[model samples]
Target: MLMILLAIASACAYGVADFLGGAATRKAKVFRVVAISAPASLAIEGLLLPVLGARWEAGSLGWGAASGAASAFAFALLYQALSIGPMAVMAPITALVSAALPVVVGLAEGDRLSATEIAGIPVAACAILLVTVKRSAGVGRVRPKAVAVAVLAGAAIATQLIMLNQAPHDSGVAPLIVGRAVSSLIVLNAAIAVRRRIDPGRPNLGLAAGAGCLDSLANLCFLLSARHGLLSVSAVIVALYPAATIVLARAVLKERISRAQWLGLGMAALGVTLLALG
Candidate 1:
């Protein structure tokens, strides 16, 4: 139950972060926004690590670093794919792959789920698809290259979560610190490399920094949830993040929620209930 609650919090945080990050991208180059967000996240995590406690374990740090690298690559591929492909098609594909792979990895590593939990998985998957699909947006012709890149992005996303989950239980927020540090460096370097091409428009630092802080919170919650519960469960619950994002878009941006999205939101609620009971 506690894990489920934590996972829900993680989802909400991720949703909000994504919303803010999306807004920030309109004002600045994607890489520039990420450079700011990554370092801001690292700074917050650094501040929280002492309060959360940590152990300097090489194995844990290594896993964290690996996750960080995966995350960096995932973002790069996701942005590139989204830039060229119709988001209506690519988003659901990426979400499904990211959610599914962790479940497979967890089960293969001997994690067992209750019957109810297993039943909820498909329900949650359906919710993910419905929430992310954006049928109203109209799926344009998706290029083969974009579809392939989207899949790779999803794989990288799953790798990040799986690697983070593999960190030792006793590592505390040490893994998060290491992961943020590595990702921050990568993003910062990328921003520097392409500084000349960056848009001269004023960047929205506030939104980017807020996204970073929320992202840090999301990561911490996910780490705790994965450590306490089944990785499959944690990943699925967290993947429901798109539902939260949709809701926020409706409420804050005054965007119309598609019928499918409304249904998906309800399905997400049902799935969460089932997982919690299981």
Candidate 2:
């Protein structure tokens, strides 16, 4: 229950961060947005360093760096796909793919679920797709090439999550700090490649920094949750973040609420209940 709550909290944090990131992207280039946000997050982590209360051993740092590399690659691919493909398709693909591998790993290790829990897996995954579903037709086609890139991005996200989960219990939040640092560096390189300013302009810069702080906090929540409970459950709960994103859209963006999104929300609640019970 504690782990489930933690993962849900992580999702809330992530959902808000994503909303902010998306808003920032509309104002600036993806790399620039990420570059500013990632470091802003790192700065907060640096401040929290003294109070994290864990031994920062080499092993933890190594795992954190590895996770960050995979995450950076994932972010790059995701941003590329978002730029090229229609978001309705790309968002669901990336979210579902990112959540898929951890479930596979957990099940393969012989974690048993009750009937409802088994049902919840597909239920939750489907909800993600529904939340990302566009009301009207989009311009981009789901080409084989685009699908391939989306899959790769998803795989990268999965790798990052699984690797980050490997951090030893005593490692504390150091993994977040190191992993976030590496990710920030990757974003900087991406900004350089695109010839975009690393630091965004005033309001955008402020927004990115705020979003970064939340993103870092979300990662920490998931990291702590994974260390506390089954990765399968943790992943599923965190994956519900799309629902949160949709709710935020309804509130902040004043986006029209679709019947499908409403149904998706209901399904998500059902899925969460089953998973929590199981």
Instruction: Tell me the whole-model lDDT of each prediction, alpha carbons only.
Output: 0.90, 0.82
Off by over 4 Å in 1: 136-138
Model 2 agreement with the true structure over 1-278: per-residue lDDT tens digits: 88878988998898888888888878776677776788899988888788886568987898899999998999889877877777777778888988899899878866677787788888888877777677556554578777778888988888887888888878878888889889888878767876744444543887788789998888888888888887887887787787888799889889887899898888888887877887
Return the TM-score for each candidate structure.
Answer: 0.97, 0.93
Candidate 1's error at 7, in angstroms? 0.7
The true-structure Cα RMSD of candidate 1 reads 1.1
Query: Candidate 1 overall Cα lDDT vs. reference?
Result: 0.90
Best by TM-score: 1
For residue 210, model 2's alpha carbon misses the true position, in angstroms, by 1.4
Candidate 2 — which residues are off by over 4 angstroms?
196-203
lDDT for each residue of candidate 1 in 94-176, tens digit (9 for 90 to 100): 88889999999999999889988998999999999999987645665678999999999999989999999999999988888
Cα deviation at 163, candidate 1, in Å, is 0.5
For all predictions, the C-alpha RMSD in Å is 1.1, 2.0
- Reference-based lDDT, residue 270, model 1: 90
